[model samples]
Target: MEALLIAIKARILELAPEFLQFPLGHLLSITPVISVFAGIFALTTWIERKGLGRIQNRLGPNRVGPVGILQPVADGLKMIFKEDVVPRSADKIVHFLAPILLVIPTMLAFSVIPYGNRLVPIDLDAGILFFFAIGGSAELIVFMAGWSSRNKYAMLGAMRAIAQMISYEVPLILSSIVVIMMAGSLSLVDIVAVQTGGFWNWHVATPWGFVGFLLFLTAALAESNRSPFDIPEAESEIIAGHMTEYSGFKYALFFLAEYLGLFAMTGLAITLFLGGFHAPFPFLNWVPAPLWFFGKFAILVALFIWIRGTLPRLRMDQLMGLAWKFMIPMSLITFAAGATWHYAGKGLLAWILCTPMLLGSYVYLGTALTKGQKVSKRVYRFAD
Candidate 1:
């Protein structure tokens, strides 16, 4: 199957016109990636809504195409026709440019992600650093949207978003560093190459890797402004937060950037910890490489959606505390554990040595963080 794919790609390259061959070929290659993610972004909205609906015991978006599959289509049309509203007092230029800035960086991060064995768009030696460097700009973009709007709520939301991002960003990068240390390469493809063989070889299967994966997932959710960590746009409190002044397609662009960012981060997680496009088991190698990649990607996306349905947003103080007081320290410990495991020869002896340390730190810190916090049990009252 791999050979066939290579042959087909070579044939297509041969068919290209001589003069425009290289540039046009590159453009053609990237077109499908952009289109696929754009479509995925649209579909995700419907999927998330439906998933959340099921969780909450409600039917979601059933009026469009069967199962409301066309809801995103309808949404796009509505946004296109809707009036674009700009606050008269706003900085028109920056207000206009903020979404574009936000989206471009998110899209650029996609270029470094290895979708399959030979499917990377631009494989840099420092791909992991490049990914995070581009991703870090999102906080600035959020600030731009808020500051340009000149609305207090928007500005406040931007401040909160920045603080949250800064806090989570530390652990996010630290957790991934553990993987880089294990793989001994910053290139994402190299990272995956080291993990090949089967599911057990994947970093997430190790004790430290497992802890790092959990920390990475937590930091990812916070960084992306996803639910339970979505305090930035808490509709009940901030009325769309940094997006309060945006309307019509401008609003839709913000939504697009957000979901695209989510997809990119999830894809990175798949690459870093879930073994990229590698099949889970030896027999599963019969599955196409890209299928293996997207299957894992989809499951992670579904997990994010499930989390949104199950958890309530954290209070601002709690959110910041989780990152600084708990996740950072835990990620640092995981990093140390990874180094120890590596030097100890990656044997059962290594596991025996490291598992207790990792588990003990997690329990100690987790208990310390949650100590004295009251768990409220709800009591239902009925009036007859």
Candidate 2:
């Protein structure tokens, strides 16, 4: 599937005039990314609302379209027509620029992700590094939105974003570094190539890879502000956090940027740990590679939605505590284990050495962190 797309793209580039070819080549590469992910973004919004409604035992958005499949279209139109409300005290320029800046970085992060064989938009040598560097700008954009709003809730959200980014970004990078080390390249394509044989060769099949994958997903949840880690947008507490003062189209941009970030993070996770676009088994290799990529992507998105429905939001203190007290230490241990696995020649000896250290650290950390907290037995009271 991806090969055909790649061939068509090459044909277009070959047919273009010299000066236009360079720009057209890039346009061909990036246009599909933008279109596909933007489509996914729309589909995710509908799926989330419907999925959440099901979890909460109700039908959601059925009035909009058939099973509300066209609900995202309705949302886009609503945002377009809604009043553009802005605070009188807000910094006009920064307020206008914040959402735009946020979306740019989020979109750029996808450029390095390997969608399928030879399907990366921008395959830099330091592809993973490029992804992270572009993604990091989102923190600054969040702060800009909050500060420019001149709203206390927004400012608080921005502050929380800073703290949250600091705490989680460390562990996120550390977890990914294990993959980079194991694969022996910063190029995401190279990393994917290393795990090409079968599911067993995938990073997540190994001890350190499994631990690293878990840590990566946990930090990704925090990074993308999903569910329990969604302190910045705790609607019950602060009413949309940094987006408190935004309205209409600008507000919609922030919403779109967020889901884009989530998709980008999920793509990176697939690239690093789930074997990218590779089929799970040699016999399955005949299947279109893009199908495998998007299939895994869909499963991860559903997992995120399930988690959002199941977990309660963490308190600010608890969120910070988890990042620093548990995630960071575990990520460090996982990194060391990856190194051990490499030096031990990636055999039973490596598994024998690395697995115990990881399991022990996990148990000790869980026990240690909860030590000072008071635990009371659940007392169920029936409603009259």
Candidate 3:
């Protein structure tokens, strides 16, 4: 299957005139990735709305298309036709440019991830570094959106978003660094290559890897401005924060950039810890590699939606406290644990040694952090 796709791509490039082939080759590689993720973005909106409605005991958007499956189309049309409103007092150029800037970096970050067997787009030696570098630009764009708007609420929201990102970004990068330490390459493709043999060889199978995966997932949620970590745009408080002033397609672009970033980060997680496109069992290798990658991607996306519905937004103080007091410390511990696992020969001795220290640190952190907080049993009052 992989060879067939490669052959088809090579054949197309061969047919193109020499001067156009360079650009044409890139177009072929890039177009499919954009198309696939754009489709996923639309589908995820429907799934999230329906899933959240089900969680809340309601039917969501049933009138748009068969059970509201075409709602994303309807929403897109509305955004496109809606009036693009700019505040009279705002810096119009930056306000207009911020969303476009946000989309660019998010899209560029997608180039390095390996989606299937031999399917990396750019394959840079420092691919993972490139991804993070592109991702960090969103922070500045967020502040740009807020500052340009000249609205107090928007500025406040942007500030919160920046702080939230800086706080969580530490543990987020640290968590992935553990994988780099083990995999010994900044190239994401190489990271995926190291875990290819079987499920047991997958990084998440080890003690530090398991801890690292959890830490990465939590930090990714925050980095993407997902809920409980969504305090920056908490509508109840700051009214969309950095995005409060955006309207029409500009507003939609921010959302599109956000979902794309989510997809990119989630894809990275799958590559780093879930063994990329590798099948769980040797027998299942017959399944297409792309299928394995997307299957895992879907599960993680659903998990994100489920969490959004289930968890309430944290208070600002609590959010910062969690990052400083817990996440960073835990991530550092996981890094140490990964080192221990490496030195202990990745044998039974490594598992026996690292597991205890990691688990023990987790228990101690939880205990010590919660020691001063008073807890009382919930008393529910029935309303008639």
Best by lDDT: 2
Q: Please list the residue runs of candidate 3 whose C-alpha ends up more than 4 Å from where it truly belongs after superposition.
A: 377-384
Cα lDDT listed for each candidate = 0.91, 0.94, 0.93
Question: Looking at candidate 3, what is the lDDT of residue 154?
Answer: 96
Higher-scoring candidate on lDDT, 1 or 3: 3
lDDT of 2 by residue, 1-384 (tens): 888998999898888899999899999988889999999999999999999999999987887878889999999999999999989999999999999999999999999999889888888999999999998999999999999999999999999988998789999999999999999999999999999989999999999999999999989999988898999999999999999999999999999999999999999999999999999998999999989999999999999999999999999999988999999999999999999999999999999999999999999998877888998987778842
TM-score of 1: 0.96
Better of 1 and 3 by TM-score: 3
Listed in order, each prediction's TM-score against the native is: 0.96, 0.97, 0.97
Prediction-by-prediction clash tally: 0, 0, 0
lDDT of 2 at 60: 76
**TM-score, cand. 2:** 0.97
Put down candidate 1 lDDT per residue, 1-384, tens digits, no spaces: 545655666788899879877886677567878999999999899999999999999988899999899999999999999999999999999999998899999889899888877778888999999999999999999999999999999999999999999999999999999999899999999999998989999999998889999899989998889998999999999999899999999999999998898899899899999999999898888888888989999999999999999999999989977898899999999989998998899999899989999999989998988999999976678832
Displacement of the residue 331 alpha carbon in candidate 2, Å: 0.5
> In model 3, what is the error at residue 135, expressed in angstroms?
0.5
RMSD of each: 2.1, 1.7, 1.7
**What is the C-alpha local distance difference test score of candidate 1?**
0.91
